[model samples]
Target: MKNLILTTAALALGAGMAMADTVRMGTEGAYPPYNFINDAGEIDGFEREVGDELCKRAQLECEWVKNDWDSIIPNLVSGNYDTIIAGMSITAERDEVIDFTQDYYPPTASAYVATSADADVTGGVVAAQTATIQAGHVAESGATLVEFATPEETIAAVRNGEADAVLADRDYLVPLVEESNGELVFVGDPVPLGGGVGMGLRESDAELRGKFDAAITSMKEDGTLNEMLKKWFGEDTATYAPDGSVVTN
Candidate 1:
């Protein structure tokens, strides 16, 4: 759901890479609750906890690598990192270039936030993080779409009146709206987007992908994944059912 379109050459390069012993987990360390830098400046968030646990369950030695959101996929394909555990949604457009494990997080909605509850989200300017599904949706929704390099910048655009509203993942925006003290309010209905978030791997890394997929399955079956989802995204967050199926509103 985020990052640039991959080039054919990049995809070919990714397909030719050899497997390594240590799985380098790549992420954009800026999106809070999903992935972010904590106060002590180390990468810490829902993804870090989940990635660590997945690596443990898979019996793999993993290390974290922080990258800018815009270049995350390109860097992964170029061998800068082994897998992308960023808050990246699984979409057909993205799956064309890289392989994805079974979704670790359930499908969630994209929502709009503005200073006013009745903001003109449909026809007015809407800001979204660059190369995201929300940005693509805004572009095709008869609205003025403004793209930013980062999620924080999209919210800033709404606050500064550069855009009428900012559309982003509901999980990411919920805490901001609550902490805004009436400065920021939700406008318009939440739009369901993407399949779900998954770990991205090179197309040639089928064995690696299978390891992560199995680990994710175990987490879902045992309810650990649901517990992590609630811990980071609030108790009302969507989760896996008893049968290991995603249960979303």
Candidate 2:
């Protein structure tokens, strides 16, 4: 595993070398737009919607499972889930452990700050999950590290100053910061990271890879995917894709 990732932003998930059709997808539904737990207690979000579309296009039964971000990849590797749909960056390092699909959504990396005040938090030591590319970025920043299993816990780490900041995704922090974590903020223009979320299958399921990829491409052509992006990130949706077709909100 080097550092293979989907670059752009607004995505979740690393792929497995193999693929599967009846996918038991994993996500941190707490991260909105990309993946979230709805009021009905059902897993829902951009990636969830995307998964549903893939199931329809590929004619497979798909189930979504919510897991802590820290455990997503491990859980997938353990066979707890079939593929990951959460906004996971497909980095080269991760590619050693898992393979990827053609990027449907891109990857985003950003800094977390206090909502009450603006501070230049970039280029410093920050807190993040272990093994994630964000952790690598934080390591490179030359700041202290506070590793946690969930982004929520990492936010708490910032509030307590255990960490100077949190290096996370832009989409993951918006609703989190807006809902009252007044001392927390998201800083910096998003630093684009690696690959987008894809269907991760056991190394034995290559057949399903073709099906999942086709589903993703079909969603892009039909506009449902972009519409979901707009609903979540608005004009900033441009960061979600490498192509330049986003209609500014």
Candidate 3:
């Protein structure tokens, strides 16, 4: 439960003033394909590309800020950043705390990876990133849920025999499973949850949210969002239509 530590000057200036007119985009720079730190130590991934385009369409000055996944929401609310463009799914619980733009990415699948194809994913110790839908599902699914601060740690738990399986976004796990050769394999049907992935904003920032919402709408209508999805998540990934319908190609 590590928290964001800000300087006295930073806190005194107020979180909103940290960027003045520029919108600070907050993300967990650990989730690959969605977001991760590149070799040059800069944020890189699907969210980075999408966030840049959204800012371009909204005509807003924007910059990226890396934050830990465990504190991402709290940091956004505290004004460490103006918006969250992380791979965060829209959920009712989160919606009550922070408003979200129209979904940029449709609700996708969650899958479990275990050492053996026949592993009892539904009943064994399951590792999942803290504060995620997959973790919540595991907590309520009669399995022992072991929470980790980062996505990589969740997978590591499975690999090190600390957990029987790891549940995470299918798109995130696909590459790992494939690269693991026979060490890891899918064990159960994909579990779908949340509404979709959207930018998180404070309730008071309706104007900012509206701008991103419109940008997302435009991307879906023109298929740029879909193209980016395929480029990062693969051509077979499910995408969102202009009206938010799930369109698999």
Candidate 4:
């Protein structure tokens, strides 16, 4: 009876460990159409759908974690989460500290928006979210770069004239522009930046990364990824072709 009791206790402990292996998917809940808090206060957006599907396909129990954009990567490194499903672009600079699944979203352009179409985006003060590729590009583009902690603040800077323009992902800016009632407009030619968006994982989680990469590939091959992209980003958004190449509109 003593040996049986010990065995049962050990089995219970093992079951609890297995249950605790839920993968935490980190994201910035502020970025809409990517990841945001819905009316129900739950993570809801394209990444949420994609992440949930990936988790299902990979057979991994997953949960969503919201983190600030500025500290997202650092928190991931500190083991605050198991993966970053934020709309993080894959970059060589970031790859130094973390691993990434294969590209889930294709390379997209960054555009400058302002109150007028003729805003001096190339040579004027430009706002960008800090620590993003858009911010880095603005810093080197000969434009005076104003860094904001959040994407919303960058747009507010442009609206209030703190910056002449705000540079951000075209996909993120399109809806804002349309809803602006002519208050905002694209000011300059869209600049291509970053390779593509991918899931960021710790450097040590190669296996976990592989699972997601495979799930993404499966989605791509089955045309589900393209469907999701179009559903969230509009019909003209870039998508994966049958040959696995990106079909940009």
Off by more than 4 A, model 2: 1-21, 115-125, 179-182, 239-249
What lDDT tens digits, residue by residue, belong to model 3 across residues 83-194?
Answer: 9888888776677677789887777788899998877787889999887778878889999999998889999999999999998888889999999978999987888766
Residue pairs with backbone atoms closer than 3 Å in model 1 (clashes) = none
Alpha-carbon runs more than 4 Å astray in model 3: 1-19, 242-244
Candidate 2 per-residue lDDT, tens place, 147-195, comes to 7766677788777767777777766777777876465666656666555
Q: Which residue pairs does candidate 4 place in steric collision?
A: none
Question: Candidate 1: which stretches are off by over 4 Å?
Answer: 1-11, 14-17
Candidate 1, overall lDDT? Answer: 0.86
* Model 4: CA > 4 A from native: 1-20
Best prediction by TM-score? 1
> What is the clash tally of candidate 3?
0
Residue 164 local lDDT, model 2: 70
Error of 4 at 173 (Å): 0.2
Cα lDDT, all candidates: 0.86, 0.64, 0.82, 0.82
Query: Which scores better on TM-score, 1 or 4?
Result: 1
